[model samples]
Target: MTAKEGVATGSVPSATPTEVADLARVEDRISFLYFERCSVSQADNSITVTDDRGTIRIPAATLSVLLLGPGTKISHKAMVAIGENGSTVVWVGERGVRMYAAGRPLTHSSSLLQRQAALVSNRRSRLAVARAMYQMRFPGEDTGGLTMQQLRGREGARIRNVYRRLSKETGVAWDRRAYDPDAYEDGTEINKALSAAHTCLYGVVHAVIVALGCSPGLGFVHTGHERSFVYDIADLYKAELSIPVAFRTVAEEPVDIGSAVRHAMRNVLYDFSLMDRAVRDIKALLNDDGMADLGGPEENHVGLWDEKVGEVAAGRQYGPDDGE
Candidate 1:
């Protein structure tokens, strides 16, 4: 292929990897950007987005996540740029009701992932993590003796209270939380708004989870499914973030409540610095040592497991009798 063709097809030399320390902190970055019915390609360090309206350039380094909706086509060069900068790319259905995500993490080490696995594997530690989650939602309250069933019931009551209070304050009619993924449009304005807002929340949270190199399927309070952990983390912010935003959006009576809710949620996420909170919260939840960043160096590493000593250095040849 010609030089121009090679560049366009992303067959040319890849860009140098950026240092993790030089990259923007997740809390300081924009939450997400949504695109649909467009074509995405890389130009230098920026990704060019083209649609009927026009073509625009966006720096790939500053982006946290890109939500590609229906009718979007992204070239390989664009994906390379996104992956190089530790940004996530997610494919979604209309109003973000359906989603699939893939990304490169900011950290190369598996420290946090190992910690999460260790915590979730044991029943005692898992229960502690679950209780810690409940405590985060209900600060200043004791959850030490509460069984899982009681804790769930308490959460239900808290959410019901939030809905009723928000409904009374906003004067938006409230019945119950009813959602059907297959029929998003059939729900009430509030339900539709809630779904849209929560989808955005889940997208960002999922991006954070991936960027940290944690398994999205391993969860504490939530279990099963590929995104069970995504649900568990997203629930931490729903009452404060999505629920209120949904109620207020419906009260405005906008022509398109879904679009309005998404915009509001974007601003809310930024204003609250949720990305930083998510990182710290996950660390605190899994680590008994305390909530520290635990970020590692940029160098890639590997080790071999030794039953007695644990994690011997790899890449060295041993004697014939030493199990090379």
Candidate 2:
């Protein structure tokens, strides 16, 4: 099914003979599946699929992307069948009926790993950029004058304020105590918190892509992690978009505790447009890299992570310490 310009929604016609044959042919391609706006019914070991048009019986193994669109219902047994297939079934509408496929090829494990590596690399790159920007924004500050602990404290406050604003705008709640600058006194705690924050943001991006039936691992900005390019793409927004918005929100309206800060953040998440802009910016970056044709059924280039690692290893391989 395809949606033309300005169409609010589109419908999938009943599967033709060729489409049915294609489904059968690709049955064994992956162990996971996703479904949208469809239903599956089970009788013993076999399953029957019902749509607005009619019903068809097929072996349980032949099913993937089992969609149950709005107003559609499925028995607990059917839900179990769907889960047992290792499929990620999405509820697209109210009635538990509309759904679509969010599955990936089972053989794409290596791709998934490469995608993850790419994501990490992309994250580091963006973080480096943000850090550079921060340094430029405050160039006169003397690093030699302040202890490392003090610098981390300042960064923690900045990050916390940003999180508070993000929580207010996005309506996503996070622990406010998680942002305590003093907690980072030893420096280790702040680093761990940042890492955790990155992982959480990555998960949200992956979920969004799964909903769109896109491959998260096949990314435009964060290329190379096998099953998580979406995460990489999301990282680009963490500092520039999410952080600044979150901080601005917090500074404008003060919150006492971490939970309250998170509560404020939930409001920010309700605006999908902000998230959409972040995705668009990522796409723009990918276009600049001359890799706009990602996520297609073709091999991708070597990831940035691999290149950096290679550079570091080569330097060590030929370093003066090698003879020691």
Candidate 3:
């Protein structure tokens, strides 16, 4: 790509591999953002999100995910800035149901992802990882002798049990896992609650997946879909996070149930410290070395984590030069 094309497309300028690799593990940004009923415009080397309330200047580089909900418009330049920052831009429906996602491809370096690909490529290794995932999901539940079919059946039973328990708690009927992404207007309260909760979880997982340089499509439990690995990791925490949040939100039965669920999901996600837990859990789920593998090769990361380096970078205010 030409330099001009690179600039227009938000390509890295004079960026070294070590720098890119260092950025891959950062967790300082807000985990999620949403834009609707406004225009996202490129202004003065930053993206300005304008709505009825006023204008909010976004340092896109410092955000994990930007959700473009309904009634949103964005400029080409704004898109470029977002991609350059390596932040994900997702077009979503009511309560964060993903419609489309923008932003850059996997850019980080991690030995864990290399190991993950190797395991996924082999039949025995892949199944072992799947079993590991199952074990991680249900702690203290021995599944060493169970086949894949049995594991799936157990997962189904566990989900049904969660629903039944929550149904009793909140009086919201969960006939089955049901929600139409295309028909958001008709989704039942329980279904909407499930979608809201999962959408938040998905955003956090996606950020970590991209940050760790792992392919979201690579999966053991959930196969297929662009967010297969996203689903697999999210399922680990779904029962504990989403189910109760959904039930409680539905029990309120507010006039604007969708909005209420969305608000509640975000609150619980932050209050419960889901982002940090997600990063830690994903590493353990995928590799024995866990968080250690996330930093990549030791030689490549001499002073990346030094406090002085962090203080300098942190002191530099966010602006047009953030990606630089």
Candidate of highest lDDT: 1
Query: Candidate 2 — worst ten consecutive residues by lDDT sum?
Result: 13-22
Off by over 4 Å in 3: 1-26, 43-46, 105-107, 288-324
lDDT of 2: 0.41
Per residue, candidate 3 scores C-alpha lDDT tens digits across 79-171 of 766665667777777667765665553353455676778888899888988898889778888998899999999998998899999898878
**TM per prediction:** 0.92, 0.31, 0.79
Ranking of models by lDDT: 1, 3, 2
Question: When superposed on Cα atoms, how far off is each prediction in RMSD?
Answer: 3.5, 15.3, 10.2
> If both were scored by lDDT, which would come out higher, candidate 1 or candidate 2?
1
**Clashing pairs counted in every model:** 0, 59, 0
Error of 3 at 145 (Å): 1.2
Model 1 Cα lDDT, one tens digit per residue, 85-195: 788898989877888999888777677788899889999999999999999999999998999999999999999999999999999999998988898888899999998
Cand. 2 TM to true fold:
0.31
Rank by TM-score (best first): 1, 3, 2
Off by over 4 Å in 1: 1-13, 288-295, 320-324
Candidate 2 residue spans exceeding 4 A from truth: 2-155, 162-175, 178-204, 208-275, 283-288, 294-324
